[model samples]
Target: MPRGFWKGLLKVLAFFAVIGGIAIAVLRVWFVDVVTVRHNGMAPTMILGDRVLVWRDARLERDDIALCRHPQDDPARWVIGRVAVMPGGEIAAERGQLRLGRDRVTHDVRGQVRFTDGETRHTFTMSWGTEEFDDYEEHLFFDRADRPFALRAMTRINGLYLLGDNRAHLGEDSRTFGPVQASGCRGEVFMRLTAAEGGLPDEIPHGALDILD
Candidate 1:
């Protein structure tokens, strides 16, 4: 082959490689992207309108905060919560502590949670308790029935159940519906960028640090 022809071919290959790389990067960011809090779910730990970077590809474990789509609702929208259970395991709330099957979990108290559901969003207020569930339970309390609701026998193989730190009063998680499936999970959250003001009261609002790998 001619020397000039070889050089030109190499340049063309390099140009295409660069273009392909850029395209891949953009697609990854779009699918495995970040979400900012428009409302309050993490509360004192995370304020309203905080920016959180999520990892759609990260391996999710118990207690890892994540961004996911609604398992029972429309998958178009995304929400945030922490992993409390694993496949074959169960999560329950007792004395404010989260129970994983029969195992007990302890967690740090961050803030309160206020949840509203349905068409108009029914409001419920819960405080930040001394203890919180650090794991997943199969039996969850149901409002309509006195008995606990048994979760799917098999945990969503692809995803984790996300929940807000403010369990009792927050609408930031699965307690309102059910656990979040893995397919619905977009990614793990790395940072929490909070708004300057307005959402929170007269409090020094600080966002969460990056948790993405």
Candidate 2:
């Protein structure tokens, strides 16, 4: 080919490269990010060492797992939980269950899972099960067969009501903190990236990636 033809091809390639770079930058800044699961707060759903993809600036709704910064202890740390109660509803939680206005959130028994906490220095087994709220449900672990779910007071959230899947004392979430502002919640954790070596708990097996519920 002529010199001019080669020059034109190179320019086109450069232009496309610049555009691709810009798109990735925008995605990283305001659209998507990856966060490692440091806590068993999400338990069987998302365990420690689980690298998850967060969709930044997500339009959150009930049952959506919100990714937000830790309000009290560390500003740098990211916290995640399910949007159990929406902003509009009259939030009231009692007897291991949550009541949003008239609708009562119920837990439908759906077997159980036993997994050890890879994040903690102390190793122990945690049993979890799927809890249902009408038709919609999530994998929320209350406790062992002997222990009942602990009750929590409703702290009115103008933005979002976040709750961890593992409702244990160890789970640091809105249970430990109060309700969080929706604006402060960065995004929603929609997918778990493929587990690396020692990336997940031994109990929960996954393939390339996990499309979260």
Candidate 3:
């Protein structure tokens, strides 16, 4: 190989390497975070093993899907839930319905969801709880005896109410602990990198996706 040709090839490779490194740094510092859904907490909207692209700096909003630290568990472990109430708001659950101030968050039953995996069939009624049915659970209530005896008013100080879409599964969420601090939040889930498939039912009652007013 000619000496000049070798030098030019080396320069080109270095240029491309620098560009790749800058792109990665930008993504890590200010762009996005890729996370995987480890559980069925935000089911239908985001299922187990679904990979998601989260905007690390987007402003949180009511009904927005987000990745945040569990209120009472390991801070390093991230939990996915919807922002039911934002900072400076009060949240409460009454009769299986969420109430924000004077307005009661309402949902419309869209349809039924059913799917089979192997020899097992799973079915449940579907509805939009906050804005989309995908991010919130259909109204499922615990028995009066099993319900929390003292339902405290969750006041968002510098945090927000992070609740799971599958309320019936109630394990890690504001309902189990309290409101989630904003500082513990990682980012807002803007896109699903994984295809919506598998044992999950695709049919929704109303429009496939609709935001509740």
Candidate 4:
């Protein structure tokens, strides 16, 4: 190649590199959150090893998936789950039923989720049901006819109430700890990632390729 052609190519590459670096900096500092699913607390909804993209400062409402600080004040730790109640709203459970402000979060049984855990090879049978809250509705996984743990009853005090979709892991979220401070939340998990082909077993619900909720 001629010297002029080489020089032009170098300049173009430098310009692109500068632009790319700036974009990445903005994303990491203010917008992007790449979260790895570390536990099966959100089983059937999200499984272990899933990579998720959480957008910072996104407005979170009931039924939205949230990424927040762990209740134990571990700066290195993060907790992700569905928002059961927004700030200042009451969330509770009666017997085995979920409720918010004395209203039941009711839904019809959609189907049964049957999937094998990729890590433990354990098979789970969870009742997939649509839970309604005000004008919004979401599908969630819960214990079947044979309950492993009863849903504990309590009312929300303050902050954001978050809970895992997998009721079998009922103690994994806000139910075990108190509500998470809304201001401390990192963001909303809007996207879930998957491999194009067979590097690992696929475990996400309905084989969803993207968008967790």
Winning candidate number (TM-score): 4
Clashing pairs in 3: 110-205, 111-205, 131-212
lDDT of 1 at 20: 87
What digit string (tens of lDDT, one per residue) describes model 3 on residues 38-87?
76556556656667788886777777777888777776888888787778
Q: Clashes in each model (backbone N, CA, C under 3 Å)?
A: 28, 0, 3, 0
Top candidate, metric lDDT: 4
Candidate 2 residues 107-206, lDDT tens each?
6554454444566544444555567775455664545555556555554466566777776635477667767788788889988875544433444555
True-structure lDDT of candidate 3: 0.62
Against the true structure, candidate 2 has what lDDT? 0.70
Q: What is the TM-score of each candidate against the true structure?
A: 0.58, 0.73, 0.66, 0.75
Instruction: Name the runs in model 3 displaced over 4 angstroms.
Output: 1-30, 115-152, 155-158, 204-213
TM-score-better candidate, 3 vs 4: 4
Candidate 3 shows a clash count of 3
lDDT of 4 by residue, 1-213 (tens): 999999999999999999999996888788987778887787667777777788998888888899998877677789989998777677656667877886877767766656555556677676766667676666656555566434455554678888888777755698788788888888898877552221122333444357677
Ten contiguous residues with the weakest lDDT in model 1:
138-147
How far in Å is the alpha carbon of 91 misplaced in model 1?
A: 1.2
